[model samples]
Target chain A: MTEEGQSEIFQKMWSRKGFRAELRAASAIAIKQWKVELSYPLSVLWFIIMPFIWFIPYLIAGTALTGSSESIHLQDLTGISDWLSYIAIGTAFTGLALSLLWGSGFALRREQNVGTLETLMTTPMNRETLVWGSTLHNLQHGGLGVILQLGASVLIFGVSLNVWGILPALAIIGLSIIAMQGVIFAVVCIVLTAKQGWMIVEFLSSILMLVAPMTYPIAVLPPILQYVSVASPLTWTVEGFRGFLMYGLAYEGVITAVIALIILDVIFVIVGTLLFRATERLVRQRGALSQF
Target chain B: MTETIQEPSTKSVESDMAYLTDFKPRIMDWSAARVFATKNLKIAIRYPANFLVWGVLPILWFAPFILMATAIAGPSTSTHFTNISGFDDFVQFSVIGWFVFMYLDNSIWGIGNNFRWEQFSGTLEPLFTAPVPRISILLGAAFSDSIQGTLQAIIMLIFAMFLFGVEYAITAIFPTVLILLIMVFALYGFGFMVAGLILVFKDPSVLTQLIAESTYMLSPIQYPVQALPKSVQAIAYVIPTTIGIITVREIAINGTMSLPAFVQSIGALGFLALIFWGLGMLSFKWAEKWTKERGHMGGF
Candidate 1:
């Protein structure tokens, strides 16, 4: 494009050219991310394969503990005796959390790594557009992971799913991904300041694994930890996903999950945007945007 | 002067030849290993946050398994597990398993990724060209990982015992120590080859992740090999950690092992230690030659 056209575009973007301009910028970043990722074919395979890598050990443990697929104790705790499906589906949902945490969390750091942070910051595109773009990229990869994991579970363990449950499950997953954006944004701020962003992710991922009911129900956690679990968007997502798939959870419970997730989504997005913008400004002022 | 030179010629020439023949660079530089290990460790120590995370990450990582097992069966013991593996307490079983798994993880990721880090930092070429033996560099990494992994593993194990109410046979400490020593040697050997493979593929995460994950699944870390299908168990035995976990657990958690089983476990680990270490050295040497020939050592 000509310099005149570029300046025109920037002028329009600066004037708050509505959601379309922001969406365009975000999609451009997403496309670029995909292009870079697709260059490494093996990494794409690993991305899809990772969920199964995590799921198998839990499967073996469950089978060994109960000596079968059914567990009466589990039934008492979660009203489900099929531990296989419970763990498999829960593990699949964790892909969303991992993608947001690892992918979007390091989005800015990644730009810094590639020597593009300065150019990116100079652009008139809203800073949150970068986050949305990375999040979109991660969601696609995470979604692929979920699909492969479910397919593998069905084939290997004969896990049955309710056909009607797919839509609600997808909805819950989408909301959970959005809710996790605030956490990812907060993590991005840490990434800007901390020398090793991975340590923070390591701590967060561990906490999520414990509290999210991925391998077990929240009832098994201590009373204090249970509150943490209750507050996590992941816990609600898993519960709702499992409820529709196997537990036959009530309609009221589904509504509650949707409402809770929607509230979390709105709060997280707003807070995440503000936090990211402020951090961006601070890093720019401190001349630390490209330090890492 | 001519008369003196005639008299000294035979002895002087013989001594000069001997000196030339004797001059050679040291094959394995222990000093280089020490330097490299110290440097790597100093860098690690500077990052206190990572150390803190590593110290506590294991408990958080393994809690889900223990909790899941408890949720399925009562917290006391699994009758089926005891029947299959002669261990009833899943918490102790998995805690020990995860502890051992950490060493394996450290060796593979630590040594393998060290080379990648070197490449990324634009030092791999210079380091390779240095006078120090290449294997010493990997050995240094192995030593650093061993030291760091050991401290973290001990702390994590202690915390796990208190948090989950896990108990082990204090009497079994001696045997467990011996088994762990052998396991470490075998793991470092495995790490050597993994480092070599990472160099060849130029992709560390995918290959290492595949190996680590596959090993976790094939090994009887979380479940008994007996619980696995016969064919799967056959494949599981190929992984050193499977036998290591079974042997350590047999002695530590189950209280004792049959003499034959004990002998078999020790013998297998010793054999693996030699085989893997030898293979590791050969693979690394070959990879070095291959990478240099292709001029890919400096290409990240």
Candidate 2:
């Protein structure tokens, strides 16, 4: 209430003890979410099946149009002769990207719907703590789903994966998830301020799919979109991922992709964090946290 | 002091009993439907971003199919696709398919999720308690979804026409509209069935996506049914949208179909529409009764 009291509270919030408390809070939130999700086993089953659901139409249409599994043009564009593997990998990654994007992007909205956002905001935990917890939950959930989905694809569709590429692919996935958290943080900022923020998330998801070469080579995109894709961390992740797993490209070949993703990770994370904190503070001052 | 309550006279009690027995509930209430429809329309229009997103989303969805098709075939056309589909313009074929797919998507997300969403928002129980026919609300939601889907599809179609240089036959518009109307009803039946499933299950997204994606793969959305395997094609024909989309393509895109085939397609779709609508209504009524008896209507 007093000036000195307020200053002390701020100092305490920034202390090392406060950071540990935030970490614990984030872990608790994530575990709570997992408990809620695990209670719905059917929903979990559907989540695993969803990647296949989305991929089938693309495979069917591609095969029908090309009259076979192999595409000469696709080979020419991406240096991969197997269209099945290309599409399977892309679909699997898209599934992961969408899960993370929608998961963390709507994390705050979900809390609000459950009537907990206002209650949680009253605590001493950092706003980023809540976001981080949701993002961490999504990362694990999505990562597991991708593994199962890809495994099923390989078994059912006869698609092959480079066994040795697993470690590097996981590393790239780790980097991409971190980079994507930045995007989700910015989305959370919008969610805090707007009623139709999910619409923006949907729009962004589509834009990401369009730009990230999810189903086709980047070379197929127009020059402008190609430039945009090059700048996106997701594009680099997908490129680096496919480079190792699909094309058997070595570490040396994918160094540029690795470097690009690292730079993008730093940029997006910093910008996303600053923007989210600013937006969170603005919404609090405007007394709009509970409006929705 | 203890309060004393007086009992009503026998005559008054008889009159109250008569009040309950005298009134008959209608099978469908058009006035309530108008209210529901108007409310849904107002709610939708209040958020213009929904419309913007709806308009743009189809194009965004269509991009992958187009890009992948181009990557597989060629930029302008694919001879293999043309051979089977009887049309070289994948863009036009895909655009038309995407238009139909939009209605399917809307019906699932909109009409299918209608009751489930109401339950989530804590309004379904109140709505059920009201003295209105349930079918009226379903119809109202269906009407709203149709209006929104049609507008969104038109926007997407116009964009595709200009962006991809797709052209349609002017004379085929009448047939296309007729087939579309039939397809819409069949889809309405599908949506109503999904709505019932959601009512009983109380899990909307997974169920909706399951039905949507299954139908999408089964039906000839972006490709001809001929392109599918023989066994799969047989199954595809049984799907309501399959005949409707194939017939529309024949009339609109390929511009040729024998008179017998045309008649067969129409008759088959008409039969499917009846079957789906009848089954959907029955299932929904059964689900409502089942949930109500179990005291699960307000449990969401």
Candidate 3:
């Protein structure tokens, strides 16, 4: 056999080994982050306790105030008698939206700050596997807090899952979250390029929560601002969740939401991946990885 | 002989005068404060892209809500608050409330997170070692945050007005601005306390998500405080942002403010500000002492 042909075969053999090594390293990093989160049980507790604290007042207030009013009209337009259920769903989804943003956007920065980014990069690990591992770790750690909060919602708000196809609604919400991974990735890239730490991301995430229709429906927003909310993933997620939980998941609107989720996920992931790869190269050239 | 004796006394008096001049300005250390603030400001603005991302992104953040609101409720539709005191216009109410919130969140987080970045850049120790007081360093950071936040709020308000067709009364603008300023300072004081905690705990990010989520829920950003139950309303009354939101709503929408409400709002804000400032200063001093003792002043 020719030397060139033999070398090509050897390269292919090494690539397989490299891929396996990368996968292992990424998993290790993800587990490490998860362990760190578990170490702080109080943080998890706060996440659980906060939602209950927020919703109880609304539940009590709704019951008391709506008693005098005709038919428990909590909102101006919509006649939602079950204000607890309405706010409970809103709060749950809002918590979910927050978990996605915080988990993905700051996950990379956290690893980088802890001096793990360079270690992982130097290994035979591929960036995609590392991202997946980090994302998975984020889901596990953040998911624990979210589940705890959900449990609190059930306990405090007395939320009853009566709607059919609730699981599919949750599945859609999960997909929408996964799609938001792209935006989170984009935010991480910006964080890397700016190197100003996580304050910018923190501010952006909070502002997004307020601007998005997480608590109140978009019917409450004015004309132009309503158009703006449509651009956010949170709106789709919230609307999709509410549509399924409140109005039986049989609406055609769910299809539009599913399609939009897929499109947004593809767009965000592709663009975010490209931006991240380019930023990684820039960081490498600047030798910033070691410095941080 | 008398003239010759007068010369020494005159020379002594001149030296004393010079000494007093030097001591007088130390009363405030305004120059040191300015330099400290300017350095941080330059760092924040050094990266134009970052400045735009941090400073201008909040406006874009409002875009999604704008789209959703318009889609659900047509542009011509107005939101009415029957339970609240004087906020008939939903768009205007949301705009002002969000503006205040955006400003508070920016300034508070900016001040609180300054230490983490300083640690990353290997500058925290030097900053701590500087002759200027720690308060000056914090004040400088807070000032930069205020500048960025104020600019963002103005841009956001303009976008909200034009996009939402929000009508504003100039007469109410001044009082609204006053309430906003009080709320900002009061909130910044709370932010300083958190920043102090960051210095001591070394894990401020742990509280970041919790703080961010709770404040928004607690504040009356989109809805009226009265919409909340009596228990929640009591809690909201204690929160500085509630006062700010209610005052702004009353002035801008109703074109009137009850004297009792105005006094209550200002009084609550003032009390909170004083409490936060006192606690923040104490915590800051303790953190400084602890860091210096442990020799971790420079260690990020």
**Chain B: TM-scores of all predictions:** 0.87, 0.89, 0.79
- Give the range of the ten consecutive residues with the poorest summed lDDT in model 2 chain B: B203-212
Question: Model 1 off-target regions past 4 Å?
Answer: A1-16, A247-252, B1-22, B25-27
For residues A40-91, what per-residue lDDT tens digits would candidate 2 score against the true structure? 8777878878878888888888877887788888888877778888888877
DockQ of candidate 2 compared with the true complex: 0.62
Error of 2 at B137 (Å): 2.9
lDDT for every model? 0.83, 0.83, 0.67
The 10 consecutive residues of candidate 1 chain B with the worst lDDT sum are B1-10
Fraction of native contacts, model 2: 0.75
Model 3 off-target regions past 4 Å?
A: A1-27, A49-91, A122-125, A163-166, A170-292, B1-27, B44-56, B59-80, B115-118, B130-141, B176-188, B258-268
Clashing pairs in 1: none
> A-chain TM-score per prediction?
0.92, 0.90, 0.80
Per-residue alpha-carbon lDDT of model 1 for B1-300, expressed as tens digits? 455434667889899898778856677899889988898889888976666567688788778777888888877577888888777677788888887778887887889888888888898889988767787898898888888888887888888888878888888899888888988988888999999987888766777888878887887777888877787888888677887888888787867779888888989999989999999999999998898899999886
TM-score of chain A of 3: 0.80
State residue A132's C-alpha deviation in candidate 2, in Å: 2.0
**lDDT over C-alpha atoms for residue B239 of model 2:** 75
lDDT by residue (A1-292, candidate 3, tens digit) is 9999999987864576565666676678788876876688767666566656555444433333333322223345454445456556766666556666766666667767777778867655566666667676666655565566556766754666545857777787688766677777777777677765576677667666755655456666657757766776777777677667766756457888777777777776788788878888898899887564
